[model samples]
Target: MNDAHLHMLVNHFPIVGTILGLIILIGGVYFRSISIKNTAYFLFIIAAVFTVFSMSTGEGAEEIVEDMPTIGHEIIHNHEELAEKFAIVLYLLGVVSVIGLITNIRNHPKATFFSYAIVAIAAVAVFLSTKVGTSGGEIRHTEIRSEAVNQNSNAASPKSENNEY
Candidate 1:
């Protein structure tokens, strides 16, 4: 498949992974379970790896769709900007997660501190994931756009018999 197809395939994992990781991390912190926390850290690292594939394929995908009728350069550019921010956050989360994992495995005194740090970073990553996901969705899903939704709702409203054309 083409880069665009590959992009579509891999793009959702980072967002989904961050969300899942965040939830599990929260639970881990609550229960003080290193294993659960490690699971979340693993997810973060995998998500970060997937970001590389997503960003790499994005350029090819942009070239393929940037000229389409409903897709504009501005929208694509916005998505690109958000994606970059999200990727950076994911990478940071991944690094922090690795350190946390190492510390936990070693029974380091600072393991709890690292867990808290990972949680904070994952929180930021989750926020960025939302922005990135929305911007990316806006690229192809015109129906979800605020203006388009308003217009569609207006058009779908029933006309009064007296005003019928």
Candidate 2:
């Protein structure tokens, strides 16, 4: 398959994974379960790895669709910008997670501190993921765009009899 297809396939995991990791991490922290915390850390690392794949394929995907009738440069540009920001956050989360995992494994006194750090980073990652995901969806899904939806609704409404064409 082409880069565009590959991108579609892999792009979702980072967003979904970060969200899942955040939830699981919260549970781990609440229960004080090292194993669950490790699982969440692993998921964050995997999500970060997938971000590389997604970003690498994104340019190719843009090239293939940017000129399409409804998909323009502006929408793709927005998505690209948000994706970059989200990727940075994900990378940071991944690094912190790895350190957290290592500290936990060694029974370091600061392990709990690392868990709190991960939670904060993951929260930021989750926020960015929502923005990136929405921007990416808007690139291809014009119906979901606010302006497009408003235009559609206006067109559907009947004009007054006094109004002339």
Candidate 3:
């Protein structure tokens, strides 16, 4: 398969994983369970790894799609920018999760701190993921574009007697 296909395959894990990891981590923290926290950490690490794969394949995907008839360079560029920020947050979350795992395994005093930190970072990642996903969706899904919304609104308006929309 081409890079675009590969990118589509791998790109979703980071967003979904981070969201799941965040929920799981919150549960772990609420219940005060080290084991659950570790599980969340593992998921975060996996998400981070997928982020790497997604970022690596992104350039190739862009090269392939940039010339397509309906795709906009600006849309891709916006998605790329948001994706970069999202990647950074995920990477930080991953590294912090590793440390959290180690500390929790050893019963370190700072394990709680790391848990909270991961929660905060994962929250940011989740927010960015929404923007990145929407922007990426706009690249191909013309029905959801801003201009499309405007056109739809205009079309839905009540017609005047003069037959002018």
| TM-score between model 1 and native | 0.92
Report the Cα RMSD per candidate: 2.9, 2.9, 2.3
Candidate 2: where are CA atoms >4 Å away? 152-165
Instruction: Give a tens-digit lDDT track for model 3, residues 1-165.
Output: 999999999999998999999999999999999999999999999999999999999999999999998896988999999999999999999999999999999999999999998999989999998898888888889999989999999999976879755
On lDDT, the candidate that comes out on top is: 2
TM-score ranking from best to worst?
Answer: 3, 2, 1
User: What lDDT does each candidate get?
Assistant: 0.94, 0.95, 0.94
Candidate 2 RMSD to the correct structure: 2.9
lDDT (10s digit) by residue, model 1, range 15-100? 99999999999999999999999999999999999999999999999999999999999999999999999999999999999999
Candidate 3 lDDT: 0.94
Model 1 misplaced regions, further than 4 Å: 153-165
Lowest lDDT sum, 10 consecutive residues, model 3, at: 156-165
Provide the TM-score for each candidate, comma-separated: 0.92, 0.92, 0.94
Query: Top TM-score: which candidate number?
Result: 3
